[model samples]
Target chain A: MDVETLALVQQLYGAQSHYIDEGHAREWAATFTPDGEFHSPSYPAPVAGTEALTKFAADFARQDGVTRHVLTNVHVTPAAGGLTVRAYLQIVRTLPGGPPELLRQTTITDDLVRHAGTWRIRRRTVRRDDMKENR
Target chain B: MDVETLALVQQLYGAQSHYIDEGHAREWAATFTPDGEFHSPSYPAPVAGTEALTKFAADFARQDGVTRHVLTNVHVTPAAGGLTVRAYLQIVRTLPGGPPELLRQTTITDDLVRHAGTWRIRRRTVRRDDMKENR
Candidate 1:
């Protein structure tokens, strides 16, 4: 990872969390490629493409709660036509007038590609901490 | 981050966890610089130096419980003669015959320096998820 590439990925990760947490669904969706996919055990199936991703973001925003997605221990590797990145994700949630609480802990692996000089997530899969499967 | 530097950091992160989890305390301590420091709210004071780090590792092993330190969302930045790395840390624990449970969620920042062509942590500070301090 060159300095530029590492910086780009760091910015993308930060912006995604900021946009979603701040209710900027469209911006959050834009962080992904047009055909990006998001998967989690909590969802019945994978959410594919920007349109669906935007819908998911909108739904999450409608809940009108505070969410902080903290990521750490990130590792990056070069892939066929893109890069593979893995990190731990910690989601803290707070309801109206309530203290923040630990909501979810998952390990996230993302496939990202450079498009028009910017890196965008092409696929993101999240596995819970207690999952039987290994990353 | 050059590719080589990134890979070296990633390998160091992975190896540290594997060594500690496998009861290889000495190997785990070797992941740090001779003067590395580990700090957390759980500790009365920072554990400094490789010798102290080995002692800490030994204490963790004596607990006789299974622990998995999962890291993610790592960000790396160049600093004075070293790199500053930050990431999320999730610790899962399991007792004999018991299922795994979420033990701790923390944000960790590490200062790593290259010594003899190898990257080693010189300082690692951990902040709990519920802490008032912002990473």
Candidate 2:
């Protein structure tokens, strides 16, 4: 029943990875809803809405080197208004003339809804493995 | 077309990750064909056949830290007899008192075949991102 939905979810995630890794800030933010929420302990505060999300992506792109945002162990579940997707995310970064470093590891839970004939994240909650206060 | 096949492939990989991370050595190796092959630059020698593959997995379980084997950016292509799966592989490790470290990042190409009513890797080649001598 959700065969196609599963595929669409995977496609969106693949695109999200590319958008952030390549510094496509606006494109990355566009993956989320206009008032999407992003909550994480790593950030100074929870970022929500379109404008802030765009700025967050832009700021993330100012790193000193290459960054690969990898997602794995994905699971999708049907929800009331949309779909719920959860996956493990790893942030690997490589500095200039240095080796790639495993910067962060976390779990991302996203509530997705249909927007503009495609999937858009309505809210995303990230729980870092190293941090114990995800709640 | 490949909707079901891709899901099966993803499930197999997810199982593989757990088999290794949880130190189920034999179970991990069993995901490979009886005469499967695994070639990687990190290992001193290429491992092939059931006996060798089982041994390789067993040896890997002796690490002094916890390791997470992550696979992302998966792409599956239909093959003449089976399927070809390619993805980026990341190894994250954390010692008893240290933070998680990105140990290795590589590309893995696998030739998969149905064995005993389940998909099994017939051959796997790992190309480390830091190594250019993949040829």
TM-scores, all candidates, are 0.65, 0.63
**Compared to the true structure, candidate 2 yields what TM-score?**
0.63
In model 1, the Cα lDDT at residue B126 comes to: 93
What is every candidate's C-alpha DockQ against the true complex, given to 2 decimals?
0.21, 0.21
Error of 2 at A23 (Å): 2.4
Give model 2's DockQ, 2 decimals: 0.21
Clash pairs detected, candidate 1:
A1-B3, A72-B72, A72-B73, A72-B87, A72-B88, A73-B72, A74-B74, A87-B72, A88-B72
Candidate 2 local Cα displacement, residue A103, angstroms = 1.2
**lDDT (C-alpha, whole model) for all candidates:** 0.78, 0.83
lDDT per residue, candidate 2, A33-123, as tens digits?
9999999888889999889999998898997899998788776767899988777788888999998877877778899999999999999
lDDT of 2 by residue, B1-135 (tens): 366887778767755875776578898899899999999999888999989988888888787766778777788898978999999888887664457887889999999999998789999999998887973
| lDDT minimum window of 10 residues, candidate 1 chain A | A126-135
Candidate 1 ranges with C-alpha deviation above 4 Å: B1-30, B33-113, B122-135
**Residue A69 alpha-carbon offset, candidate 1, angstroms:** 1.5
Evaluate candidate 2 and give its CAPRI docking class based on DockQ.
Answer: incorrect
